[model samples]
Target: MRAAEIRLPGVAPVVVDREVPRAGDGEVVVEVVAAPVTPLDVLCAGGKSYFGVPRTPYVPGVQGVGTVDGRLVWFPTSAGMEPGDGSMAGAAVARRSDLVELPDGVDPVLVAAAGLSAVAAHMAMTWRGELVAGEQVVVLGAGGVVGQAAVQLARLAGARRVVAAARSAEARTRAAAAGADAVVALDTSDHMELVGRFLAACDGAADLVLDPLFGVPAAAAAHTLRAGGRMVTLGASAGRTCPLDAAVLYGRSLRLLGYTNKELTGAQQGEAVGVVAGAVARGELVVAHEVVELGEVTGAWERQEAGVVRGRVVLVP
Candidate 1:
């Protein structure tokens, strides 16, 4: 089996020939078809994330769609957070509990590229954000794959209005095309200016905020929330530390909730995957991505790490 692995921390993964991983008891050996380069994979290989330092010479894929004994499925890897290799290979050993089998008609590569990210956005709006029909939504970082999924999911979840904020003109255009009722171009360098523009675009009010950019965008979106509104933060794409006015936070009686794919129980994760994959199957959701071969993992990996790519990168093995 040829696998892309990181031999040490703070290094890029390299493709090497290695023995195929064997499944232990209660686990399954999956023949990988498509694996997406995700932030979790990048952060873990860096040896510094909530996942902590990873063991050297481990595979660097967090999730992938594959076939377990001929049944197609998706599985997540916490190798960066644990002691194990992952699915960036010809085959992988996955826990039975973590597998989400796909329907027969679905595209495994598209699911691999879009499923997990869609789950993050879908869960943020429905479960953690507690968004309801007739409520207004503001999606920050609405350009990345997750962000694009969020803009559509927010509308599908019954939001009366959906406003998208992104830094690039292309991103903002993509956001609008993805179903954001309105789009705001957030100035990457000016935090306060970004906040002001978001508020203006949203008409100074919103009921729910699905934030992926935690630093400047988060703080700016905070001020636009209506009194007693809620915000669910899922990632820190722009920056980690966000400054918030105590008065705005306290006086408005707002709620700030944090969510991540790691927090969901196995059953919940599986259920979310089903919903997301079903939406894709029905054309309710679609993800833009570039397909790269296994040998080109280095370039795809670098694209993900640079944080410049606006679409999902699926590695087909």
Candidate 2:
């Protein structure tokens, strides 16, 4: 079997020949099809994440779309989070409990690209944020995979207006393409200026916020929320600590919530993946992504880590 091996921490994986993995009692062997180079994979492989340094000389993929007993499925792997090889190979070993059967006609590469990122967007907005129809939504970091998915999922959930904010012109364009009602640039450091831009774009206060970028953007978006509005944050690409105003929270009685995929049970994760796959099958949800062969893993991994890719990078093995 051929796989991409992370021989060293904080470095790209190299293609190497390895013995095909054997399934254990509770595990199954999946013929890998498509694997995504997610931020979590990069974080874990960096040896700097809270999960701590991972064992080296291992495959580096957190999730992938593959076939188990000839049935198409989406599965997650411990990978860099634990001492094990992942889905970035011709075959991967995954617990049967972790497999989610994908819907018919859904593109494996697309599903792999969206994967947990889309699940986070969907769950954060509906389950954690309690988003309702006819509500206004503001999505921060609207160009990334999670942001792109959140923008469309909000609309699919019947949001009356969806405002998107991103740090780059390209990101803003991608947000617009994802059906955002209005797009705001996070170019300025002036918090009040950003709040003004968001307010102007939203027409009025937003009822919900899908915030992936913390720090300044999250703080600014907080001011755009309506009284009692909810902000569900799932990532901190902008910054770990936000400069949110205490007044904004108390004065408006706003709800600040956090979300993570790990908080969901196997059933919840499976259901969310099914929903996302259904959306993709219906062509109602699409995120920008680039596909490359498994042999190109190094370049794709480097590009993803450097934020040079416009969207998620899927490696087809």
Candidate 3:
């Protein structure tokens, strides 16, 4: 089997030949069709994540779209977070329970690109953020996969308006393409300026906020929320610590919640993946992505880590 191996920590993966993995009890071998180079893959492989330093010379994909027993499915692997080869190869082992059967007619590359990022966005907005129809939404980090998905999913869930904010001009453009009612720049260091921009874009206050970037963006978005509005944060790409005003919480009685895919059961993950896949199949949802051959994993991985890629990078094996 041809696979991308992370031979060293903090290094990009290189294509290498490896033995085909054999599935064990409760596991199956998925003939990987497409695998996404996600941030988790880079973080774990870098040996700097909370997951701790992973065993070296391992495959690094966390999730992929593939087939088992001729049934198309989306599967997850422990990979860089644990001692196992992952879906970045032509064949990878996955627990049967972790497989989510994708909807018919969906593109494998597209589903693989969206993968857990989309799942996180959907789950956070609906389950954790308690988003409701006819309500306004504000999405932070709207350029990333999660943000893009949230922008679209909020509308699908009946949000009256969706406001997006991102730190870069390219990101802002992507957010606009995702159907956000208004796009605001997230590049400012002044909290009040960001809050004012958000307020203006939302035309008042939002009912729900899907926040992936924390730090100033989180604090600013919080100020643009209506009384009792909910903010669900899944990642801290911008900063780990937020400078949220204490008065905002008390004055508005706002809700601040954390979300992670780790908290979801296999059933819950599968259901969310199914929803995302179905939406993609219906042409109602899409995320910007670039597909590269599995052999070019090194360059693709480097590009993604350097933040040069415009969207998710999917490796087709």
Candidate 4:
């Protein structure tokens, strides 16, 4: 078997030749079909992500679609991140319970794209965010995998309107295609004005904000909300800390919630994967994918790290 490993931080992954191991009890060895390179994976590669830095020389992929014992399957949690190998390899071991059976009609490329983004979006919106149907939602950083997925999932979850915020025309178009009611670029001098514009488009105040970019965007989304609105922060792409006004939240009775898939139980992960897979199978949720050969994994990682790629980039091993 061949695998890609992050030999060190701030560098490209190094390909290493190794032998594939057999599956143990309660485990299934998945023949890697496709895996997506995500921002989190990039951060992990650079040793800058909030998740404690992983050991060097370890495979680094969070999720992948594969086949286990002739059954089409995908695993959400990265065995690679937990002191074991990952989907960057030709084969990887997955816990039997953690393996999700992909629907016969779902494409492996799409499943690879959906990967972690779909599960996280589904989990954050339904379980942690308590999203309500007919409520307005503002998705920050609504261009990346998770952001785009959040926009689509919010619509599928029955939100009345979805507002997507990004900084490029291409990103805005992609968000619109994914199902945003309105798209706004966030590079203007006055972001507060932009928030007002989003609220105006929504016909009033927003009810929910699916925020991945914290700091300025979080503050902007906070102000865009109606009384008693909620903003969920799953990623701090902008920065970790932000200047928040207690009075603003207190006066509006607004709530700020933070979420991460790491905190979820196994059953919770299963539920999220099930919902996202079913949605993808039914054609209700679309997963955009860009496939690259396993030999190109290093270049794919560099491109993703440089933010030069659009949609989800999947590695076919």
Candidate with maximal lDDT? 2
Give the runs in model 1 whose Cα sits over 4 Å from its true position.
188-192
Provide the overall lDDT of each model, using Cα atoms, as 2-decimal numbers. 0.86, 0.93, 0.92, 0.80
Clashing pairs in 1: none
TM-score list, all predictions = 0.94, 0.98, 0.98, 0.93
Q: What is the C-alpha local distance difference test score of candidate 4?
A: 0.80
Q: What is candidate 1's lDDT per residue for 214-262, written digit by digit as tens?
A: 8878888888899999999998877888888789899999999999887
| Structure candidate 4, residue pairs in collision | none
Query: Which ranges in model 3 have alpha carbons more than 4 Å from their true place?
Result: none
Better of 1 and 4 by lDDT: 1
- Which TM-score value belongs to model 3? 0.98
Q: Which stretches of candidate 4 lie over 4 Å from their true place?
A: 48-53, 77-80
Give me the displacement of residue 188 in model 4, in angstroms: 1.9
Model 2 ranges with Cα > 4 A deviation: none
Clashes of each: 0, 0, 0, 0
